[model samples]
Target: MPKPKIELHVHLEGTVRPALLADIAVGNGMAPPAPSPGRFADLHDFIVTWNATTGCLRTPTDYRIALLAYAEEAAGHGAVHIEPIVDAEPRLGLDGWADVLAACVDAAAEARERYGVSVGLTPQVFRGQDVGYAEEAARIAVRFAGRGVVGFGLSGAEGRHPTLPYARAVALARDGGLPFVPHAGEAAGPEAVREVLAMGAARIRHGVRAVDDPDLVTELVERGIVLDVCPTSNLRLRVADPGRPHPLTLLHHAGVRCSVSTDDPALFDITLSDEYAVAAGLGVDAASAYAAGLAGMLGTDTDRARLVRIGRAAFGGIDVGPAS
Candidate 1:
């Protein structure tokens, strides 16, 4: 078996199996969205697909099924730990958030027993929505912290939606002792990455764009902020040129912490193992990848320590430094 890995940038909605989604949509008396060729034309097209797929999941049971399926698939890819972003937007309603979160927690517990993969939920505030909605999402996240949810995140179109307005929500997450992890530097640029840092982000999803500004890269290194980089997602979204080397290599060489992940694995048609393969292709050794993953995980210290031991044993007793 390959070394045990950790995935920190996955999305539950984005991991729904298309066949299951179609079945659920028909069962709900709703028309299923048309299937695409897997690769999207652009970020907007991808978001449209994402929204349509998530629309099929209307009940708490739907979320439970999706979470379990994601867990099984992630575990198959050798993921020992996964922190997936769960979006409970207008579809589930504010009051329904608790049920869905509880369902996820239950499903995750079952998945741990069945698949040996620890799951953590990170409820996201859609940045494209109004700031009030973000605040409400943060409150719900705070309410569920330590029960099932491990952190708070902001997702959506980063190009048009500035992360500054979500400051109140970020503050609330910080006050609740939840890690602040927001998407940045993918659809947007270095400035967007800077904004999330200002909001006290411990990790930045798809922060590969931070390589554009040397100063910001230095700041990320100095602060020990992890960039959860998804190579295939960047290639599929056209955020990075396929012909060029990925920014993960640049950031890692610059002493910025980075972890490989399969962002929207089902949507991007990739896997955690494939992501590790890509990292290896970029000259990242297994020990270094293990180190980055350990640093990037948002799980409890005990969980982190256990994974380190697993990785060390799996990879021939390689030293992985600290658990972070």
Candidate 2:
């Protein structure tokens, strides 16, 4: 049997393969956006590239296809659970985002029925983007609470924007019964992580830089906060020194709760399986990483228990359960 795996921080727009994007682009009678370069100079560079890559998506059907495609491919590679972030504003307004979420929810249902991959959608608010839109997304996510939306997140060039302005947005999401899981500690340093932690984030994406402050790391360990680490994405974005093992390895070794992810798998040319291997090579083994991923999921106890059962068989009898 294949190793059981869970993805904690993958973006929905970043999952569409070039071929899939081209197909959608051609179907819509528009030329596909230029291919993305393999490596980005920085997070700012990556964001610009990421936006260009999402130009192919113009309708809800395109979102449905992208969601289903990633679910199918990821499930084939042993991803038992995947939470995809969908946050493309301007290109999509609140109404369109709701449509995309509905389409993704229906598409996730199909993935569950056919591929058996448990997928939940996450709505993200860009840091410093309109607070009104951010609050609206939170309010909107409430309607899809158990249906498909599982988590709420903040994404942007963390260096350019502060997390303080979005506190209300995070509070709104939490009030709507969604977990606040935002991207931090990648483009910025430990302070960025602290800001989100203060906002009651359930888990953090790309929090490798928390290692810079040893005391902060201890606090994370004490709080059992899970930093969803993406080694490939980090190195590609230059957040992690390529010559060294990723910072999450240090955080993990120091007892910080760490989980593996592919922050933007297709955009980074990686899979959940590949990320697990990368972390393993950095001294974070698949079993522990997968276990942390499971523990960090936003699913209900009953949903998590069901996944634990699947994980046991998927990992060929390795057990990690009793999700709290």
Candidate 3:
């Protein structure tokens, strides 16, 4: 839709197509989730569905298939670069974690060569999990540093496990020269956003609630910490209604560095293009959407020339200032 945009905050496991998950489950001796999984009542319910889908990913082949499927989907949406969060610990046992990461890198390399789309892997630690697990993820990330691994992230429930819990892991990742990104302000409020900021987060995933704290918003804008905001996920999670009460517009107005993304497109039945379409329908002008996308590209280490080309082609030009 936007000529191969960059997707910054998507989870590779959660983006598994339902049909593929069923197929993988059958192939891998696992049971897929129930037919409809009873309509998700909220974000927690959605996570339940997500874990079930992730059950399909029990082997390296499954990881490869998931990566390839997501790459193909991103390509179909005209996404040139995709940054998918990877959790080697869950899918690949600690002893074989390096092999797991290597498999993902190889799969992404294959996708780039065969499909003409680039995918960068960012290993993630599920917060609310043992802090030791995060440290282990960081260690493994450091081991694979500079080898197709671009950044590190923290996912899972942020409200229960405070951002400071992973402070040491973030520091380790940053020390190893990886960009630090953590989930914050999605289910939690603006306070979570502040905690992530204190932890030296380079980019925040789903920081929509940062609008609730003007001082923090100002600091974010000043420091250039990009928020990868997924609008459809916000609405589906009941964090915000898409139309009247979404704080994304307010965050942009407050000079927050924000970007649009599809958090879990398959789970939510949406895509990067769908995300852009929803934003447009919800009153975010084409230019603002373009800037948001630019902020995302700017926040990452993607190809600058390609980003500039897409930015100009998408909106004729990019102002890259606060949305007014």
Candidate 4:
């Protein structure tokens, strides 16, 4: 087996291959979404495609299939752990969330038994939503913390919606023993990253723009917040500067804990192994990020120890240092 690594950022809906989504849509008696282009025009285009595709998931079986397929592919990428962010669909009542969570939990158990892969589901609240829905997302996340949901994710257009409006939701999740891992510094600048940090973000999704601010970078180093960086996603969405090397290189060099990931593997057509290779080619220590992420996951100590042992057995000496 290849060196066991961890993918700390991915989207549950976006992980489903377009072809598979078409199949599910047909099975659900709905028309499939239009075939996506080679790359999206922008985040808005991506979200439109996302909603059209994921809207077909009407049953628990669809959710199970999505997660298991992702786990199978991730395992082939030498991934022993994956944290896939699931959108908190406002239409889903608490009952609907429970069914989806139940399906995911079963799929996670099967993945562990079948592929030796551990799965953590992170429920995401969109920044574009009102406080009521965001707070409900937090409540649902808290309600299912240990069963399968391991983290709380804040997503949506951070540039348009400031974190202040969603502070209470984040705080509720954090107080309920769920780690806050919000999307920041992608659609916005370093100031957006600071807002999430102020909300007690344990890990940030695509915080590459923090490199634009030296003080913010230093604060990240001092506070030990991991930025789950996805190079392909950044490049595809035009979030990273095309003229410069990927920011994970600079962030790692500056002592910011950055874990390479596939934000939306199927949508980006990138794998976790490919992402690690990209980071390594740019002189980032992906192995260290894996170690840190494994140690920092909300899983129990026993699970962390087992994952570390599996990684060390493959790659040898995965350093779990300050990155955790």
lDDT (Cα, 0-100) at 123 in candidate 4: 84
Model 2 TM-score is 0.95
Report the C-alpha displacement of residue 17, candidate 2, in angstroms.
Answer: 0.6
- Give the number of the best model, judged by lDDT: 2
- The better-scoring model by TM-score among 2 and 4 is 2
lDDT tens digits by residue: candidate 2, 1-324: 567678888888888988988999999899888887869999999988887888678889999999889888888878888888888476778898788888988998998888888887887889868888788877887789888889899989887877788888788888988889999998999999998998888999988899899999999999989888888888999999978767977988998767788887878887778888888898888777777888788866766887788767656545466643
The count of backbone overlaps in candidate 1 is 0
Please write out the lDDT profile of model 1 over residues 227-314, one tens digit for every residue: 9888888888888887887898889899987888888877776778888898888877666776777787787777787888888787
Which stretches in model 1 have alpha-carbon errors above 4 Å? Answer: 316-319
TM-score of each: 0.95, 0.95, 0.90, 0.94
- Return whichever of 2 and 3 wins on lDDT: 2
Ranking by lDDT: 2, 1, 4, 3
Model 4: per-residue Cα lDDT at residue 284:
71
TM-score of 4: 0.94
Winner by lDDT between candidate 4 and candidate 3: 4
Worst 10 residues of 4 by lDDT: 315-324
Instruction: Quote the lDDT for 4 in model 2.
Output: 68
